[model samples]
Target: FSLYRSYFGKTSLEYHLQTLENNLTNLVKRNSELENQMAKLIQICQQVEVNTAMHEAKLVEECDELVEIIRQRKQVIAVKIKESKVMKLRKLAQQIANCRQCLERSSALITQAEQSLKENDHARFLQTARNVAERVAMATASSQVLIPDVNLNEAFDNFALDFSREKKILEGLDYLTAPNPPSIREELCTASHDTITVHWTSEDEFSVTSYELQYTIYTGQTNFISLYNSADSWMIVPNIKQNHYTVHGLQSGTRYIFFVKAINQAGSRNSEPARLKTNSQPFKLDPKTAHKKLRLSNDCLTMEKDESSLKKSHTPERFSGTGSYGAAGNVFIDSGCHYWEVLLGASTWYAIGVAYKSAPKNEWSGKNSSSWVFSRCNNNFMVRHDGKEMLVEASLQLRRLGVLLDYDNNSLSFYDAMSSQHIHTFEISFLLPVVPTFMIWNKSVMILSGLPVPDFVEGTSLDHQEQQQQQMGLCRQESPYLTGMKNCH
Candidate 1:
């Protein structure tokens, strides 16, 4: 009995010690994890603090400038008031001198009337009295009221041929001398690669007769070719009466800066030049799901419409009938975000978007819920989904366009590639990966963009890699990530 009790007690003691050791190991692991998380939280809080400081500084600067402008304007108004008061006082002193002469003239007329009465000539006496009254009338020179011989007809001589008493024509024509330039209100590139639209606010501050648009494309070297033939060097779009202008004939995938000048009677005013970059993207057409009338190039990156005959693509996934000229893109996405541009070369009608694998063929690309598209029917623009249509106004010359897809957020958007105008966006509940889609109408050609997409992910895009290489110094002896690992060890 004594041997058994000793054995049981020793066994129980060993088990308790082993359990305590295991508990200690778990607690250490948990502590390490908590420390790492705390460090990450501290870093995030520091970043937020820095960002807040930057924004606060910017707001403070703008507020100070606004307050200074108010102060200057107030000073100017006070100076003008002082000058006006001096002028009024001088005029009042001159009027007092005139009033003395009027009193002397009145006394002379009254004395003449009394002399005529003494001579017994009543008619002469009455005439002298009438003269005295006329001298004292409100119409006398010493009276407060002063009138200028200004004619309404004369004022409206060049403004209008016919003038009436009730209807006074203002100075209709703007002054020939150039006025200040119109300030830019908004500007953007269009769907067409070579076109850009600019809008400026009409300068109510200055009378603007017209405007001229000047633009320059960045041509690598210092040499630049003007759009218009002008020796002065700047190409000009003259006599733009409206506040908005759409500039045509620009190169695709190029950078351009536009300048607008408002002209009036005195001089011309120029706005601060605006700079923009055209959209760029590279994509290929998938021939496996291409429709009959759509012919894919050997490179499979471009598609053209051929109504003469059908190409022999036997894929069951292909479009048919109403959608007999559709092609899917080689790239498909299920996660992350991407942007791509397409050049629609003189195409009358076309559609661009992303479509699910099981999208219906009987309906147009945008008419099905599985597909979301920005489509053009002749000159009209429409965003269609699930047979519903939302019409939007875009120029008839839309050529280059862009698509932005966010798979994780389930959002798709389209824009004019040249001007960067937001055309449309669709919220999607993606059940499957969606492929880029192209639709052709009549005899249109869809040119896939050759520019690379903006790389947002770590390894998905070339631009992202280049950015990483620049930031991380890929050739450095010790990378920041490596140094971090070493520190952790």
Candidate 2:
């Protein structure tokens, strides 16, 4: 006993007890974890049962709807068949009655002829025989008319039922499934300044009940997955029956991405996305804002400097004074990118650009802080803003000039449309909406508004850093080599 006590000391006892306690704690933790897992599995089993029942009920409901439709159609077709049978029987019965009447009349004529033949006295026999013979001849001659015109072969053959197509349809019936995706026909799509008409085609059009169109403004992003996930900005139009849909009240000069969904009783499938853009805002010169000597023609699109032009009373909106020959457009632009072209038709001296509504109309457009313009005076080309001018290199043979105004980005650029060359760009932080302004000292200029921005011009816009440098340059004083041209208007 003394030896055993020495081997198993107080430390050994405590270590053994500690090991058992740790094992017990681990076992308790594992038991609790197993219980939680069991509870979750039981809950999942119950959910599965509910889902199964729900799906079965839906299946039955769909089947019942199909059956009900078939039943209604059957009733309608039965009524039609019964109506035809009644009409046919009525016609046959009338024909039978006519035949019976004809038979009875013939029998009576035969009896009269026999009785005339049986008469003993010669005179009585002669008179009776003559009348009877006449009666007999009339009855025999009219046999064709009295006979019923019933045709034995006229059994309701015309009204026979051919339900082969319906039988095939019924045999092919099955549970509804999602329709195939639709395809957007980009070539067939058209757009105007404020509307886009999206055209599409579907292979499963017969199965599809309706269509859903979704669109959102495109911001030059190529990641379609990310764009589709950002549904907050998407606009949805549902219950469309036609294959093509025209979305009105859209922003001009803006790009949009569209998607079409073919929907049925089961579900829906989306088409591949398509990108479309709208033309620039359409505008025409406002005659009310034309200068006194400036003549407008061609539906207010062409302007000319005429010496004998009719003079009118000047208003606050009209361009007045002897040296200012200008006009403003009818539309004011506050947002979105816009593009327009000017047909400079032998016009050597002209000014083209945008100006604020409060800009001074009595002075040259670009001579004040509220306007910006590219001017051509004799052989020199320059851009003027806020009483300062900068010489910009341009072709002397420039016949068509392109102007792109990006209001949201604060950019206004000019290009030689004939040669596709960039002329100049002005960066302005606009405080209000602006309208297209034009000035001419000789000849005429035609305005072409509502044009899409050319691809070359769109890609030629300066980058952020270059635009910053250019903006800084614009903020400086006028170029030293540039000199102010005298107002010849």
Among all candidates shown, the one with the greatest lDDT: 2
Angstrom error at residue 64, model 1 = 62
Single out the weakest 10-residue window by summed lDDT for candidate 2: 480-489
Task: Enumerate residue pairs that collide in model 2.
Answer: none
lDDT string, candidate 2, 339-390, tens digits: 9999999999889999999998778878889999999989988888888887
lDDT, candidate 1, at 13: 93
Clash number for candidate 2: 0
Candidate 1 residue 412 Cα shift, in angstroms, is 0.9
Scanning candidate 1 in windows of ten residues, the lowest lDDT window is 480-489
The local lDDT score (0 to 100) that residue 211 gets in candidate 2 is 100
Model 1 Cα lDDT, one tens digit per residue, 1-489 = 889999999999999999999999999999999999999999999999997798678667866886797589779977876786676666665656666655566566667656656865678768866766665464456334333232233322243323353234223422244565567754333424446677777555446777888877633333323333334545679998888788776554355666787876556767766655444324578787778877778888677888765657566777675544788887666654556777888887787888888887645786667888888777667666664555665767677787776565566766676765556556667999888888877565555453433332212333333442442233223333223321110
TM-scores for every predicted model: 0.36, 0.68
Error of 1 at 303 (Å): 1.3
